[model samples]
Each structure stands twice: as C-alpha cells, then as structure tokens.
Target: MPFYSCFAHSLIQNGYHYSRKSPWTASQNIAAVESLGICHSFVLHCIISSFPGLPLVNPIPTKSLEGKSLIIRVFIEQFYENLEEATIGRWLKAEGDRVGDQEPLVEIITDKITFELPAPGSGVVRSIISREKSVVPVGCVIGLLGEPDDPLPDVSAENRATLERRQREVESQALIPSPETVAPEASVSERVRDRGKVRATPAARRVARENGMDLAEVAASIGGGLIQEEDVQRWIERRGSST
Candidate 1:
C-alpha cells in the first residue's frame, strides 16, 4: 500500500482507526484540511469549534411598505455638535392635521441658525417624535407625516405669496454674516498657524484630549515624529488595559 503523506487524508484515516482518539485542535485540523481545497469544511469546523451546534440560517426579507407617506427627517443645523443646543419650535401644522406640499411644518433653531422644515408632500401630520425645546441632531426623525384620507386643497397663489413673505421675514430676522465673509482672514491665518504647530491632525488631537492622554506620550513612540490617530488609539488601549 502506497503511504499517502497528505495531512488531511492521514487525519481522516487515523480518526476512523482511533474512534476514541482525543479531538484534534482546530488550528491543526484547519491547516491540514485547508491544503486539500476543503475550505467550506474547514470554515464549518472553525464555526463549530467556536460555537458548537449553533444554528446558521440566512436572514428573512423584510416586507416593503411601498406607497406609504414620505417621512422627512430634519436636522437642526449643518453640523453635528449643534444638536446639543438646537430647539424645535411650535409646530406650524398640528398633529393629525393635513398639510400641503412645501408647507412650513416646523421651525428649527440652533446657534444663530434658524430655518423652516417644509412638508415634503401633501399628508396628515400623524405624530410628533420630538417635542418643543428638545434638541435634535442631523438626520433625526422629528415627526411622521402620513397620507390623508382626503388631502387638503393646495395653497392658493395669494396664500403662497403670504407664506413667502413670512419666510422672508423670518430669514431677515435670523440673518447672520456668511462664514466666508466673517472669517476669511482669520481662517487663512489659522490654517498657516496649524501647519507650523505640529504634525498631528485635528481628529487625533480630539481623540487624545477625550481620552485624557498627552500628545507627548504618543510622540515618543512614533519614529516619523508625527502623531497619528492609530498611535492615539494604541495609547488609549494600553492605558485602559493597565488601569
């Protein structure tokens, strides 16, 4: 009989001969079987070793709710940090009220920012998720607007003009100098100052600060003399483990 030097074949043969043999280590078995193009079997062995007899099944599909009323999620401002101070003012349309397209549904304010959130389509205001004075972030669902059994009439031209005037009045009251005009020179100076200060990025600085870590600790380990996010993360992990 020709002796097969194949590890997987040898293990299979031995496994049968010694039925009561001690179980082979996963890593050893995987290394042996993997060379024989038994990738699926190797993966199954690994999974079984890690989580014995756990049922594996594909996820079921979710039922689609097509033709449902459009939901508009509003953010108070363009940035995420403003969420802490943002406020949702009184609802322009009451809950369970029908509204037309482009109708002002709510007034949102953050920092010096104020704007009207318009109804995306003609629908009844089914529910309000966020109450007045509540701070909401970007992409937050503040309310649900659903299709009305009988939609309200579209806004007349005269009412549309009046609404436009109201919008203009609000815009005028909340106007602030554009960022570009207000900080053009300061922005340039800050960029130049930041470039000369250190090699670390702003994100890395933020991470270091939040973790109560000193940037100097990271500077000591990196050979390139530049502080990086990874260095900050590693420092954080080591510090956490030590504590």
Candidate 2:
C-alpha cells in the first residue's frame, strides 16, 4: 500500500474520520489532530519519513523543534539599561504580511534615539499587539508571528503586568496639574476664610489695616494673587479715581 493509503488507514483505525464529500484542508486536519491530543511534530515526522530526502516547504523548523510550535512572539527589548519604556514608532509589517528572517518589523523610539526592531524569524505576522505611537515598557509583547493557521500563545504574564503598571503611571502623571497651570481656586477658599491672615506683604497689611480697609478686597481686585505693597497703592489710587 502507498504511504498516503497507510496514513489514512492508521487514522481510521485510531477512530479519526474526515468528511468524504470534500477534501480535508490543512486547518481542519490540524484542528482534528489537536482535538485528539495528537502531536503535530509526530504527524510531520511521519510525512517526512515517507518521502525520504525530499525538501519540505513547512515554515516550522522541524529539525530544531521537538514538540514546540512555530508561533513567535515579538517583544520590546531594552536597548539601554536606563531605558525602561519606549514608544512604538510604527509597524513596518502589518498583520498577515509575510516577513523574512531578521527583517525590520517595527520602529522603536526611545529618549536617546529611534531604531528599527527586526523580526526574529521568518513567518507571517499574526497580530500587532501594540499600536503605533503608543508607549509600552521593555519586555512587553508588541507583536506575534506564525503560520497562517497556527495558534498564537498568550502574552507573558510578567510583561502584561509591567505594561499595565507603566500605563497607570502615565495616566497618573497626566492627571496631575503642572505648577504653572495650578488654579488659584485651590487655595482661594483657605485664604478667603482667613481674611485677617491674607497672603500679603506686612507693609501692605499695615497700610490697609490703618486705613480701615480689608486686605481681601485688595487681593480680589488683583485677580486673587498675592497682595504686594505696590499693588495695594495701585488699588488705593484706582479707588480714589473711581470715587
């Protein structure tokens, strides 16, 4: 019997059956084998053994791999010890695009310089986990590659946690107000509640108090800023003019 016939017989004896109406596709075969807990490498070895010395076009490195899969995860590597985070400049290869070994896959922008990240192996890009112009920490899973129908593995737990932590830090920093942008209303109530101890120079305070004037009124006229002695004199002049 031919090798194909023997292979079919083996599958049938093992209780595995395929639809006769249409030929079984590669994906369907893989799914069936996975459901039966059959190793893919074993099946490949049988095929290779059947046809001795014939070159196979399979993307999987069968010689180097035992039971390992062809799925490859692309990580954001740290170029410098001090570079903990980086921005994803762009993806050179989109999802579903075939890439060559060591070809430029994406651009990583750091504080020091921007560089292209190379593909670790030859395969079709399965997914782009990180978005362009987004920031992710070193060691985070940025992309994935594998055969068209191959299953992708989950991102590393450690990398996911680090990415989440970095995102939270960025969000927290965004929520904080800058020193120059801080509103006067933040401390306006405290200053307003204590009119006697308003934020004004001693000379301004003495002049206003001796004239039976409220420092709070002078402070308000200057847009709730500190009441300098010159500011108080200007308010006095403006009041005299308005009267």
Candidate 3:
C-alpha cells in the first residue's frame, strides 16, 4: 500500500481524522501515532510521503514574488540526530550557476565527517547566504535558488540572529579532542620504545614534555617520523591548541 494510504487508514481505524488539524505540534502528533505501536521511521516516512509537493526536508519556500515564482531556500540538512550545527566547508556552485536537482552544491563538515550537501531542486544559484567555513545551525539557510531573473529574497533578521547565537555557543564551549584528533588508520611503524622511554630526539622530547603531551602517543600517531619539534607542533594544532 502507498505510505499515505496505509497510514491514513491506520489513523482512521484508531479514530483520528486525516485532514483535521489537531491541537498537537508535529512532534507531538508523531509521538501520539507511535503510541499505537507504529515504527518511528515508518510514521515519519508517511508524514513526508504525504507532502508530495512540498520540499520539507531541505527547502523552505520563500515569499512568492508577485505570485509568479517561489524561491527555494537551501539549508544544511541534519544527517545525524545529535548534530545541531556544522561548518560550511565550501560551495561547489556559486551564485548564478545553473544547478540540477540533487547536484552536489556545498560541502558541510560536522564533528564526525565531511559530506557534500545537494541542491534541493533545479534552478540557478540565486544567492550565497553563508560563506565558506561558516559554522551554521542545521536548518539555517546557506543559499537560495530560483530563476536567473528572480530577485533575491531577504533573509530575516531572526534567522541570521539564530546563526550568530549558535556560532557564539560553539566558540564559548570548552575544547575537547574529537575523533579527528587521531589518525583514522594506524600507519606501518614499530613502536619507538627503548629502556622505558619513547625514542624521540632531544628537541621533540623537550617540546612534548613542556606541553605535557606523551611522546609515545606522538610517535604512534605519525607512525614513522623520528619525532621532531615540528611534529609536536603539528600535533598541537590537530589537538585544537593555540600553543
């Protein structure tokens, strides 16, 4: 059965109206439906499937210009449940470039990984709202798309303020080592261990000790270098340190 048909039938069977507006929010509605033992993904799928004409996942409809055309607002889609913000790595298509539906548009980097976000629909890239390396909250508009002649829609102050707030929060948070802090795969090298000491040069050893970093860990990270002061400095940068 089609998702909307099956879901509507289930709701009707449980004494709910498909077209009637409920007092509950969307999340509340989902939760209420799930109480009937429906799978969460299935319920969410049905909700999205019901909206065939709407680009609810990534595009927001801008105010129709004289009722002629609607602009698509491109946003950073949330790929992970726990991810709230991401950095705009770079834009593949700049303003005025024609793009097809689902073409790779921009690179987005989260704490876990970097991935390309696709264009929501076919149109010319009308405006680039967020620049490269900007840290924006998920669902924040990073660009806009429409016909080449369409006027650029104004981004509301509220949305820009929200992005600013998220950036500030991220900046004020304490630094911590993330998965990217360490190399993903170990390289080929024997552990530089000798007489209960990490086999590092004097300068490397001195720098590591002063920074309170373990030289063995540094040796293991690089895999083959004879651990130099430069190596320690690079490691510090990767570790999110200013020193």
Candidate 4:
C-alpha cells in the first residue's frame, strides 16, 4: 500500500480527520500539514508506522499559531511618588466612542491636580469601569477598548466593582442640581479646546472654566488688560454673537 493509504488507514483508526479547501491534491494536503508543523518523522510514527519507504524530513518547522487576538485596557497609574490611588475626576469620551492617538479618554485627579488620561491606541471605548468621582486603585482596570467591529467582552470582576461604584455615584449626583445632565455635547467640546496656560484672575478663570471659554484667547479680547470676571462675561457674549 502507498504511504498515503497507510496514513489514511491509521487516521481512521485513531478517529482523526483532515480537511482543506476543495481542489486540494494529496501532495497539497501533505504540504499544508507540514507547514502546520507536522514533521514527517512524527507523522510516520503516529499515522503510518506500519508503512515502509517513507521519506525522512531534514528538519521540523516551528508551529504556526492560530487565533490571533487584540486587547485594550486603561489603567490607573502612579502619577506621583508613593501615590496609592487616583480619582476619576471626569470622562472625556463616553462608552462606544472612538478615540484617536493622543486623545484624552478621561480626566484623573491625584493630589488635587487634574491630568488627562490618554488612550494608548486608536480604538472604540467599549466599557468604563470607573465613572466620574469614583476612586480606583493604582494599576486597576478603569476602562476597556477594542476595534470598532470587535465584540464587547465580558468584563472582569474588578471592572464590575467599578461599574457598581459608578451607579452609586450617579445616585448621589442625582441629589444635586448639577447642570451636567443637561449640558450639550458641543459645549463639552468647547471646554476641551479652552484648556491650556492662560492669564486670568481666579474669579475670571472660574467663570471662563464654567463657560468653556479659552482664557488664552479670551485675554486677547482685553488687549493685554487684566482679565476680570466681567471680561470673561464679555468674552462669552462675544463668542455667543460670533456663533
């Protein structure tokens, strides 16, 4: 009997089968198996030991892996020495939103300083473990992301805890008369654009921050004069008119 016939007989006895695209020849099937790291020596031993005159192979190629996967996770890092935890001050991108390179995904607060937490790669934000005002331990999973077409994965237990914490925070936020619930998305974009080093008094700065006005540009409206609270108001009116 031929080597292939003996191999086929052994495969049937062992309850193993091989398949490939149609129009594949016997030679093509063997080549494909060899490409997948099935060495001739191993093949002859396992599937055709009874046969004789099998050609010996020079070397066995490394196995080619299957099932490539992608992963995306955002962690709370140690921004300062001896920092143990960080607070999720706010979220810049909502769930399911696609973030590009260097884009801020969330705002984190540590030691009373706010910092932008940027995305590591361009991908869709699939899940948020921590919500605004929620505290998370350093190196914990605070968010998840993946390709736009990738299926949402089941979150880990650590993520589940953060989600629950967000729910509680939401309930607490509901008790306050905060305007964030009704703020328009455009206003949020404007706020992100307005951030940077700017010259303004604390009161004027607060007003500008509240209205999403860039103090850096708002100061130009004053022509090198002191940016007061009234100056910020005027700038807002000017911005409203320009729109």
Candidate 3, residues 93-196, lDDT tens digits: the string is: 98889987678999999999999987765678888998999988775778877777655555656467657876787777636557655554532333444324
Candidates' RMSD to native = 28.0, 15.0, 15.2, 23.5
Cα lDDT tens digits for candidate 4, 97-157:
8887458889999886788988754568878877899988665678876655544445576
**Judged by TM-score, which candidate is best?**
3
Model 1 residue pairs with clashes: none
Query: Cα lDDT of all candidates, in order?
Result: 0.52, 0.67, 0.65, 0.60
Instruction: State the lDDT at 90 in candidate 4.
Output: 82
Pick by lDDT: which candidate is best? 2
TM-score of 4: 0.37
Tens digit per residue, CA lDDT, model 2, 1-243? 375575556556555443344554343343333333444333343343344323212222323223445566677766778788789998999999998767899999999999898876567999899899988877677887777877666666646676787788879999999875787665665565677656898898888877777788787777676788888888888888999
TM-score-wise, the better of 1 and 4 is 4
> Candidate 3: what lDDT?
0.65
Model 2 global lDDT (CA atoms, 0 to 1): 0.67
Q: How many Å off is the CA of 228 in candidate 3?
A: 42
- Report how far off residue 213 is in candidate 3 (Å): 43
Task: Give the Å error, residue 94, model 4.
Answer: 0.8
Error of 3 at 167 (Å): 11
Task: Give TM per candidate.
Answer: 0.31, 0.41, 0.42, 0.37
TM-score of 2: 0.41
